[model samples]
Target: MDTILYPLEWFVAFVMVGFHKIFSTIGLNAESGWTWALSIVGLVVVLRILLIPLFVKQIKSSRRLQLIQPEMQKIQAKYKGKKILSPARSRPRK
Candidate 1:
């Protein structure tokens, strides 16, 4: 949890700073609701850009899984097992 604080702060600060700069350039106050709205848009665009590669990788992964679907189904059909048994362990009473 502690490790996540820096990234969270960085993202928030990034959006705020971006908003401030844009607002300053456009002669709008940083505290305006419109400024905040555009800042959120800026954040969304930045995040989308950053995640593009990950999204592409995920798409590729899904395609690979799709390709394997037939084989997986065949394996499941072969297994068509009723139930799986596992060794049970006793828990101590409090």
Candidate 2:
């Protein structure tokens, strides 16, 4: 488990440090606790910005699925109680 998470840990640290550098360059104190806290917040904001497209796609997909739900239900109802013969059952009797 630690092995799998090692890369992610590195990535998170890299993002935080990058944000810290940016903040420090912007005249924020390099040693202040608030600077570090803002770095963490910056990381969260960056991650959310990166995920916006994925979130939009997921919402669109959900809406499309919802629109087709009635059709899916109708199909399910049409097939309800109908016997679905398997390959083994469909074979001619010996």
Among these predictions, the greatest lDDT belongs to 2
lDDT of 1 by residue, 1-94 (tens): 8687989888778776877688768987766788777877888888899999999999999999999999999989987975655455344447
* Candidate that scores best on TM-score: 2
lDDT of 2 by residue, 1-94 (tens): 9999999899899999999999999999999998999999998998899999999999999999999999999999999999999999999998
Report how far residue 80 has shifted in candidate 2, in Å.
6.3
* Model 1: lDDT of residue 91: 48
When superposed on Cα atoms, how far off is each prediction in RMSD? 5.2, 2.8
User: Each candidate's lDDT (Cα)?
Assistant: 0.82, 0.96
TM-score of each: 0.72, 0.73
TM-score of 2: 0.73
